[model samples]
Target: MSSGGSAQRPEGLGTRTSRGIYVSATTPGSGKSLVALGLAEALHSHTDRIGFFKPVVAGTTPDADPMVALIRSRYNLDPAVCRGGLTAREVRKYLAEGKREEIGARTVDVFSEIAAQCDVVVVEGTDLVGQDSAVEFALNARLANDLGCPMVAVVSGRDRTPEEIADAVDVARKELQAAHCSLLMMMVNRAAPQHLDEISAAIRPGVSHRPVYVIPEIEEISRPTTGEVSSLLALRQIAGRADMEREVRDVKVAAMSVANFIGVLETGDLVIVPGDRADIMVGALASTFSPEFPVPSAMILTGGLSPDEHILPLLAPAPFPIFAYPEDTYHAARSVSEVRSEIWSGQRRKVASALGAWSKRVDDAEILERLNLPRPETMTPLRFLHELVGRARVDRRHIVLPEGTDVRILRAAEILHRRDVCDLTILGDDGQVREIAGSNGISLSGMPILNPATSDLRERFAHEYARLRAHRGVDLPRALEAMLDVSYFGTMMVQLGLVDGMVSGAAHTTAHTIRPALEFVKTSPGVKVVSSVFFMLLPDRVLVYGDCAVNPEPDAEQLADIAIASAETAAQFGVLPRVAMLSYSTGASGSGATVDKVRRATELVRERRPDLAVEGPIQYDAAVDASIAATKLPGSNVAGQATVFIFPDLNTGNNTYKAVQQSAGAVAVGPVLQGLRKPVNDLSRGCTVEDIVNTVAITAVQAQAVHAQTLQAQAG
Candidate 1:
């Protein structure tokens, strides 16, 4: 649909703005519109208040514009907002008159109306056909900047060499940068089948921060159905009008004998034969019912052809539509061949097929993550989770869910799998898991379910467990029994590099989940104690509290390790690490055993990791409140700006985190266990599905971080 907004909003339209992503194309026929549709569908799954906008639409009328009508109907977006954009004619007129800024001004004026009502608007750029692509490209860049939305650039790869496609992508990136438009991701659509790998490789190195996807051309999506042909060609239907929606895959001119024509018939062939050929009609109609024969899409009888009245009864039950034309067979065949294939909003079957193909090629989760929307001034729980999930999606990691028997685990697994946030393997009896999932209306059709009891890895895992714990006198029998426990099996998977991480404790104790990991996975080299951190999402920012879930009665040395690990964890999740070794007193105000332990821990942290910014022996009020810190610990770097707080022992750590979580209404995302050889995170036994999902995401990110560190160390 074209621009639907009036010149301006009604009385008192303030300057409030909205967040959105712009879908722009490198050239025409780039399938950018399809990407917009897929994006709207993806956003709908996350929220219902979704909006679709086009800065410049192909047409002005909603009925005349298939894409805008489709978005409005499919996503239930307001038609007015979907149609709110400038027509190409209006944009060109402004540009031609040296009024480029006018184009941005008018578009933004319209966008403001749409953005005012919706949480996010998906803005589609201009179709590059019938105009100079350079101008259209420049216009897209300007409009994206004016609307204050990041872009997902769709590069057209069809009919171009890999080198040319790469060149186009580079040009798009440069132009966007020149206009100061932010890029979210790069998608190359309709890429040549043979050159997919090359095109994808060439365009990615320059934009490593963004995810790149190369989707090969799908033929079914470009084929028009019989109904579209009938509507476009104005054919008179003879029979089976209901079957006109069948696709016309190929065109066949049957001017030969019945036997000869039947031999040439192929599936989805639109047969154009002369009228009154009873023999030809019978053979074609009869083949439709036979399983062995190829099914024709529809038959077009030319030269005013109509079967004899006596044969009308036999043709009434035709599986495909039959149409009559006033022209000859040659013209009818030409018309069928020239039928323009377009993804119309009315064609539900074609739209569904197109979306399925689009989804297969495009990872919407990664795209959403790359958006990295403008953050709020305050770090709310929702915003923290958003950032967490986004980081995990950018590079997916395989995480095993050990507590597959728990309904919450199953549901969270399904959600994670469906979102493509990461690859997940569920450990349990396959049948029972599926039965529970099925009974609960959860679709685990494509999710991988691994049964540890019957798996080939069981024997290997048991042997490895025995070997690793030989000093503890664990024999094959004892290790084998331990391997039967899903937690042990999952931790073994992480240790053996079968999976990137493990997430459990949904249906087990914290000890049951962490013991296996501690026994076998152990701690990374140079790390003295295995500790945990809870990401305390306060009203203003996210704070990390360490040794909250593990390490009971830790001494000064162990407390130092937890402080360092927690600082690293905070930095890993995009928080600035200002370490605060919290105590019962501020500075040297008190001299109790706990205060002495914290003071010693702070000294140890400074000696070991001089690069870390750590301060300690501080009270909670002095550690957090800048005004109070000024009164108590003057000129202290981490007195009031701490993002990582290390507790002296588990008794203080656990209770403090819990108290803050409940009393402050803050979201405690973890006790995310850090300093492990492999990432194995534990969840609360009473955790919800959302909790499990977040923990798995955190684990995946930890695995990624660990891997990067290993790589960097090797290179060093």
Candidate 2:
């Protein structure tokens, strides 16, 4: 394998440039070139600026490749890059001498030219994993390393057992050390319809860590005609109905010149030029023999140029279909490139069939790339909730009131529902709730308030409570008293699948909410304790601090549980969870009960679930500061930076987060509830209407998740 750093681009190059994709395979005759070409065409469809780089050709001549030539010609690129026809001598010599270094140099040189002018360059490697005969028999891995580009390994279509498939993948992974390179995804080309199931099953687990896309084979190659291309460019017709070889008919062509080439130009088209500059065109045309379309259709030379004598002779020797525009070559080219972007993007008649074919091949790559792209901030819940006000979903949304509900809580709920945030419901009567809200100056505009106290719920709940708690307790009065508590009743509404997730805790503690859930809704069987995550929003990134609001001074086992829960919650929010068990010191630096708890928690976490990405006993700075981490904990997974920070206790968790928020101006959103069997959030007693709405969204999401889980469980 060849090994070297990426070559730097020449300075002062134009902004228009291309990146290169080096497509490699495990073995020869695997359609690597075909796939590479298709990728180039697909990328071209997305962007006009691109260059194809094939660094090594075992049996090629002078960098000459017919496919490369076709792309250059079809795109109207500089002819100096026509490898198949122009670089035949060089390719032949390389093959004769087997001098791969020369090939590498030439490849780099060609790419340098492309990089300077293109946005992305696509480099297709020779067939097979280790086929580098043209360059010291170097491996593709080394080439990718040198190019400093990620690679997409292409495998062939064939029937194989899961083990066999995994074996093949294992070989590639081991050779490339993909874990370090982040070689994101892979493509399985030419898969058949019937083979998809078997292939998917075989590769799913093998490539589960990476995205694997299957590309079906196309039956034929379809190319658009040149006339159609021109028509499409001119917005005359949409092309690509037929294959590439179709004959093109005569079409109007626009040409610009300062010389007297109008007499040389065919008549049916319009030409723009200076009346006095016609001679400049003729002088240039006199020295050139490249075929031009016949036309004296129209000429508008700028600078008042008129047609010269030599222009007519030039026209006589030209073919049919020609017109002249008012600008020089420079302006004409600019106009064509701009006005024809649609045509360039498969908009014309000669739709490059290869481009479509290539798109199919790299469909998986596109998906993976999109997955890596950043999403809009508006998609976040906190941002979405700032606009939503009361009664958003149900017309008469049922709001449950827990015991000891305070005026602040009731007033906030009224504002939320009146603003259409939720339908307000109270444990007490409408009159009493109104009296309470009015006393607090709460405007319950559109709110539909209800009181469960005097309503039939006392009796209904009395009976339901007996039915649910018949053996647990005795005495109707005592049972009614217990059932009448807000936590018990509110939790009952959720358990009976009546309302969505409920938010409480103004007059209650976290233990109250936790107690009802454990008694009624219960925790997920897989979970031990209810952990929470706070979406800590710093000026730059959103940090997820977990078990901060819950789990005070948790033991190693509890910390492990918190770590797992936090990691999962982070994933739910689209973050690739990297759990960092935080402490005052990183690794083994500090000796203390808390440090041991964090370290032991990290170990327990790995023992319980080895698949998770967990790091422990890392200080805040070491967990988040790259510089500090590199100095103290080199190579530790969670040392340099962590997205999920797991604290050992509520004191550290709450205080640290509050300090960050107050002192650093961080927006500490959420103390989002996690590990519940169903989604229910506990709002801070001092929360605002906005907080209620956000909690509602979280509840809604949790409700949907519970519904989905029920269906999945039933199906299973």
Candidate with the greatest lDDT versus the true structure = 1
Quote each prediction's TM-score: 0.58, 0.44
The deviation in Å at residue 221 for candidate 2 is 59
Worst 10 residues of 1 by lDDT: 4-13
Q: What TM-score number comes out for model 2?
A: 0.44
* Candidate 2 lDDT, 1-716, residue by residue in tens: 23444343221122222255557775433445556655554454344355665565533463455445555655445544333212434644765787645655556666666666765666666555334332321446555555555666666664544456556655655544532332434666655645665666676433335446665443222222333334433422111121222222122222444333534543223233333454543433332232232222222233223356655445433222223334454554344333211112232122223333343334534442532322333222322332221113322334454532366565455444433334444554565555444333333445545455555566666676667666777556765776667777777777776675677766678888767777657678788888888877664456788876777778888888888988877776556688889888877778888898889999988998898877878888888889998998898877776889998899989988889889988766677888888766777766664555556645555565566678899999
What does candidate 1 score in Cα RMSD to the true structure? 13.1
Q: Name the 10 consecutive residues with the lowest summed lDDT in model 2.
A: 236-245
Top model number, TM-score: 1
Cα lDDT tens digits, model 1, 494-603, are 99888999999988898998999889898999998888999998755789998888888999999999888888888899898999898888888789889999999999
